[model samples]
Target chain A: MSQLKRVQQWATFARVWHIYDAAWQNPFQSAELLKKYLMGMHKPIYHPMNDCGDHVIVINTADVALPGDEWKKRVYFHHTGYPGGASWTLAWELHKKNPTMVMKKAVYNSMDRSLQRRYTMERLHLYPDANVPLNLLENVSNQIKQLRPKPKRLDEYKEEEVREFPKLIDLPKSYIVE
Target chain B: MVFTSVVNYVRARGPDEIWRKRRIFKLAAHFIGRRRNCYSIALRNVHRALAYATKGRKLKRADMANLWETRVRAGCEQHNISYETFREGLARTDILLNRKTLADLACWEPYSFKALTDIAKRRALDDGLAGIKADTSIDRIITRGTLHRDK
Candidate 1:
């Protein structure tokens, strides 16, 4: 190939490093989004036989939100291949044991059952917090936008902004505060 | 050449049977075992292979188109633009590039593709295309279509 063609080839097949903040994001929903990048489905050159998958670094996995009461209602099942070895762990319990496991398993289970699943999983880097290794952080050139905007807590608002906010009706001084 | 009798005509095949079988065998040359060496088996496999080849030709084109659409969509998503919005915007701006070319630009000529997306974004915003919300980031992109429009 000519020099320009060779460079184009490299550019097309280049492995992009994407960073996703899992804070307040549902793991299942995030997994579907992350799967696209992990498998390089976003790329035009993506093929099942082509190793064009990108590296995805997911941060704040510990803070990943489960929709509604999923943290308590959802269960992860596992079997040890012996009698009475099967076990079920609640989502919250599993998350407490390993903060990254929920997000990891979500992405794992979201993919199709194929021999390439394990290899593709290898490219995913999950962190419980934002403290990623410098080398890995340095490689992240793109950020995957959160599916839903992160909800801000009342405490997160500035005092001035909160105080200046419009009120439909002011509470009486006699009213007891919760 | 006229056959003297019906028996002679039956004995005389139209063409060389060996050469006819050779054509089928040639197609199945890569097949393993009896399929490659045996004429009847080779013929059956060759016919099936040709049918698949014909179907695969159409499938290949469709697959490539799908791949190009995927690549172009990826590029659009990277720029925070939906594929439909991008295409609509491009179409409105009179940029008639096809998916394959757009896909090529997305992969090999990223800067050009980015420029195209910028134009598309501006057009989409101006036209108030669905799924394209106004954003301050693309406000600075000035396209010819917007040049004459009231702000």
Candidate 2:
């Protein structure tokens, strides 16, 4: 009877895949919503020690759009240890080369940096093309809630990020006067 | 009775305002002096606090600049340009841009930043007339040493 109840609970919580026709203007924001829609944060067994969640299948990564000129302006950097050896790639180029990477990066950034992060990431199914046939959103929607609004940027935070270099490039007073 | 006692005590004092000021100053002096029993120590502590606050402000400013430089360098690398190479290209092209401004521009207006890089590319291509490889634009130089492995 207990085993039967477990199966019944799984069936009740199970999601039917659904896709909204709305444009993915903010892929990160959409991903955050879909994370809940896919039941990525819950388990039927109610185990805190165990990672329990459902897989999320994301489609139309290539069609994901954004407002403003975020692609060309956002930069990602990497380095090689030589005196003059570092390389960079623009968000626009990355979008062209691998569209799914943009959303993946956003999702990765949004995830909590705990042991569960990797487990959660593994359940995220991202596809560049919009051809997935799973429509399990009904069961998923019940457990999901809209994300809390982020606080507005304050001037103090912006002022804190400003970097000012020393005008004097000469050696310190502790060094020899010569 | 308490009010009368207080009035009486105040009346016992002199009419001069200087004495009141002196009394306040003396109270402050005593309060501070009581903490360490030396006026020099109190003065030194105040000076030290000011010095620490000044140093802390300076450190915060420097740290912010370092963050900006790091972000710009990272942004430049994404554009296939090193912070140094990008600066060199900007200087060579006579573009008077600072790292902070460049970083903000890069984040807020990427297309314009790319145009700047393209200008550098055009200059590099034109200057490589002696078979120095015109295709080695700032981007190429920046990407030449990039690691392909995932971070």
Candidate 3:
């Protein structure tokens, strides 16, 4: 018998995956990607009751970008039982306080609202930068691509590159070139 | 009003002897016993049947809801979480799943349901500020202090 057939009979449930280098990527698309693996929806053998999900290692979340003014407009609300204990936190404020929280929340809300969702959430490990520890890093057997193109930082451009690029319009003398 | 040389019971109804052919008896047509043909008995039977049906409709709904709750409770027990805690936690967190779906998840899809219980358990603990003590205990790992080299 083939090894593939043998493995098929056992129903190997999950595998860990790494999603790195998503700097300045859209959180919405990232959330959508995470949902597929978290729910095992991408698997051929996925069942509603089964926990055959893929564990996701999300690193470099500090540079995640939200389209439009969502950073200021999006509000997260939580309330305590007391008379007036409700608290609202803006996206940018949350990002400033904890860089990984935005991604964590995105992934958390994407899953089905059940106790199983918590377990799936546990599988999603978030790191603010590329420096994920050695142990968790080893568990990652696969690497997933980013949802959107990474934004090129200003520093990434070559010193002489500006001269070669096309100019759409003649700049005014007062508009000093950077 | 003028009274014509009126045609009252002088002519026979022929094959359609329908003195009892009002809407009430028509509703009772499918009923059994003397109620099938006898007007008075049919009227009473129809009234009783319709009344019972109206009441039973409400009761049937309640009964189904109760059954779903019972299943959900059983599922909770199977998953080692109390039904009340599960419900309260989900409700407080605004998870907002109805009992029918919860019950279905519990019975046919145990793992999916177990996930819901986990969320409930977390919410219950987080419900600390709400001054509500959690009724169930779920295992949680809070920190990863050090990284180890794997073999």
Judging by DockQ against the true structure, name the best candidate. 1
- The TM-score obtained for chain B by all candidates, in the order given, is 0.87, 0.51, 0.67
**What does candidate 2's lDDT look like per residue over A50-85, in tens digits?**
344566666667766665887878776757888777
TM-score of each: 0.73, 0.35, 0.50
User: Per-residue error at A131 for model 1, in Å?
Assistant: 4.7
Say which prediction, candidate 2 or candidate 3, comes out ahead on lDDT.
3
True contacts kept of each: 0.67, 0.00, 0.00
Per-model CA lDDT versus the true structure:
0.91, 0.58, 0.74
Off by over 4 Å in 2: A2-4, A9-23, A37-39, A42-48, A79-86, A133-178, B1-151
Question: Per-residue CA lDDT of candidate 1, range A76-120, in tens?
Answer: 999999999999999999999999999999999999999999999
Task: Report how far residue B20 has shifted in candidate 1, in Å.
Answer: 3.5
- The prediction achieving the highest TM-score against the true structure is 1
Tens digits of per-residue lDDT for model 1 on B1-151?
Answer: 8656988778888779888887788889899999999888888889899999999999999998988898899899879899999999999999999999999999878889999998898999888788987778777888776787865
**Two-way DockQ contest, 1 vs 3, winner:** 1
User: Looking at model 3, how many pairs of residues clash?
Assistant: 8
Rank by DockQ, highest first.
1, 3, 2
Worst 10 residues of 2 chain B by lDDT: B142-151
Model 2: lDDT equals 0.58
Q: Which of candidates 1 and 2 is the stronger one according to lDDT? A: 1
